[model samples]
Target: MQRFLPLIIVLVLVGVFLRMMTLEGRNPNEIKSVLIGKPVPEFTLPGLLEEEADLTNAYFNREEPVLVNFFASWCVPCRAEHENLMKLAQEHGVTIVGVAYKDRHADALEFLDELGNPFSRTALDRNGRLAIDFGVTGVPETFVVDADGIITYRHWGPVVGDGLEKAILPALEEAR
Candidate 1:
């Protein structure tokens, strides 16, 4: 029985090692949102550029797919993907709703001034409450919502490089 105990311990250790190996090389940026297949949370946020206006799901017309992107002035990845966002807004004429999460109004304004804003409507999430409702972990996360107001897909990290062609474009089509 003592000799068999040593063999069993060795087998257990080998199994544990193999299981850990399976986790390696996995993409850490991929986060499947619990909100997928669900309706976007309803909230009213102050406009990023204007104080008199408010942004709410009520304004979302159930006739076109839209991109809801959470970004911050301080997030480097957000800056990197700004151009692609512009392409979506101008080239494809896609509607993009931007959320400036946890950034000062002045800073967000400055960032947009430097990068050229591409948002159809920009909301200011000063306390990040809206981002919390959306289950956002960090800045530069994007969600594709169908015309029915259902969230179809979520993309973590910056959507640039081949991500625009391979993942983002396809998801937008699916949402439509």
Candidate 2:
């Protein structure tokens, strides 16, 4: 019994060490970028306006560069970023698409109405499948896809006021 006690203690210590190492090395903020310089993933979701609006076909047409933003009514950061999106739509001629991540259609509509709808089109990702395809970890993630349908830049977390002028606009210009 004494010999086994020592072995158990050693095993527990090793487990603790491993867990500590993993926690120290892993960064929650360090989200990996995907589809960079590649064609964006093809997906179809319901538009926010209609129960059956075809978002997939509309997105695939290369009329202009597209900004796809993953957001939810429940996300505070999304509300924080909403104004920036609205400004981009109104001022910059930038087409913005919203994906209502894991949210109900009615709630998403209410959020848009309350915040001012900036999105040229809003897609319903009721199950988060499209969000997963886009490598979204959480709400308020944004992706910029060029007119040629290539994904150029991805921003994790909320798109702050400065982020639009600094990062998003430049990428859109380059893609154009």
Candidate 3:
């Protein structure tokens, strides 16, 4: 029995590790952010629209929580999430700030025109500097920022189906 004790402990450790990997709401592809519970990184990006002012970290200084979405005109998942974004802004009156990551202004404009512009302010991250600061790994990533400019939640993929109700709405309420 003493000789078998080591093998039993090893098996228990392996089982625990595997259980963690398969935990609910844990996605193998998700890249966890280091910025959660921290203030948003300071950034200044040109507005996607020529007539609009530049978007800066100061835009997040508000009395309400804001959704910061990283998207691209070329990303198909971004299109899929557009409807939820619009619903959040229009129906729920959630303020959203869009960062167009590594996309041309014209293409972004066309994409918004085709779907509908949900962003109260849209900025261009043409060089991906802002996205990098935000620790964005891909298109359609979103961060929920509280009134104090701290990141409360991060959604790694397109906000579709249950993502809006289950995750985003709850995060927003918590931020409030």
Pairs of residues clashing in candidate 1 = none
Candidate 1 deviant stretches above 4 angstroms: 1-29
Report the candidate with higher TM-score, 1 versus 3. Answer: 3
Q: What lDDT tens digits, residue by residue, belong to model 2 across residues 97-169?
A: 8899999989999999899999888889999998888888899899888888888888888889688878888
Candidate structures ordered by TM-score, highest first: 3, 1, 2
Each candidate structure's TM-score, on Cα atoms with residue i matched to residue i, is 0.86, 0.80, 0.91
Summarize candidate 1's per-residue lDDT along 24-70 as a digit string, tens digits.
Answer: 75554566699998888999999998643899987665698899999
lDDT of 2 at 92: 89
Steric overlap count per candidate: 0, 0, 0
Candidate 1 lDDT trough over 10 residues, lowest sum = 23-32
Model 3 spans with C-alpha error above 4 angstroms: 1-13
* Candidate 2, run of 10 with poorest lDDT: 51-60
- Model 3's alpha-carbon lDDT is 0.94
What would the per-residue lDDT of candidate 3 be over residues 1-176, giving only the tens digit for each residue? 99999999999999999998999978988989999999989988999988889999998888999999999999999999999999999999999999999999999999999999999999999999999999999999999999999999999999999999999999999999
Measured with C-alpha atoms, the lDDT of residue 168 in candidate 1 is: 89
